[model samples]
Target: MSDIYDLITKRMDLLTREKEVFADNILRSSVPGEREKVIKFKNLVTHGGATPKAQATGLKSTNKNHLSLSTHLGSTRMTTKKTDSDVSLSGNTINAEDQLRKINDATTKYYEMTSLYQSYMRRHNTVITGR
Candidate 1:
């Protein structure tokens, strides 16, 4: 169980790094207008929530999952643009979006797993300590 915990922690750390990398790539690949649009979309998605100010801060989100919602929003926008036009999507943008999505999905899974492990540990400790 300790080994499993260690593995989960490592995976979570890796996912965090991966998410950051993808977010950076998405931001780098986006034009100024596209960036603005993505920020607006992200704000709308997270509107009236705890992180309403995320839009003004370089597309960062305050969500606990450590996944950057901006990347997903940008990806959606890129897909829409591609669909609206007859031209093929830029490979770099598509790849970055795909990577971001995969990283976000993995981050969510690892976060849930880590939470469950922590809960189990707390229960075990409570039984052992009888407190």
Candidate 2:
């Protein structure tokens, strides 16, 4: 349905914003007194008389060493905040390696959403067109 497509587009947009922020941080890693920006997602209540909520299922990290990915579940927008990462001798709060890792994660998520969108389109077409 159109709702699914809209959701996919919105999520892709969020990932794009995330990538831009991480890229900006990487670019400013050498600048003094520059603090890294982090994007956080918050839950919002969509008023429709408050129907009973269903249990949410999502990916979880089983190992302590595994890299944790942001879910951004049920979030329509993101809020940017200064990161608490330790600053280097140059007084730059951005860690290039960490930024790169975050960028990679965002990029991965973007592609995954793209793939899901394409798959949904295929299914939709199949349903509509007797193929």
Identify the candidate with maximal lDDT: 2
Query: Which candidate achieves the best TM-score against the true structure?
Result: 2
Cα lDDT tens digits for candidate 1, 1-131: 57877666655654555566557546655443332112234442545322433546656656757776544323322112232322224333224456568667867877797897788789889999998
In Å, residue 8's CA in model 1 sits off its true spot by: 1.5
Worst 10 residues of 1 by lDDT: 78-87
> What's the residue-level lDDT of 3 in candidate 1?
83
Per-prediction TM-score, please?
0.43, 0.68
lDDT of each: 0.52, 0.69
lDDT of 2 by residue, 1-28 (tens): 7999978997887788788878987887
In candidate 1, list every pair of residues with a backbone clash: none
Worst 10 residues of 2 by lDDT: 47-56
List the pairs of residues colliding in candidate 2.
none
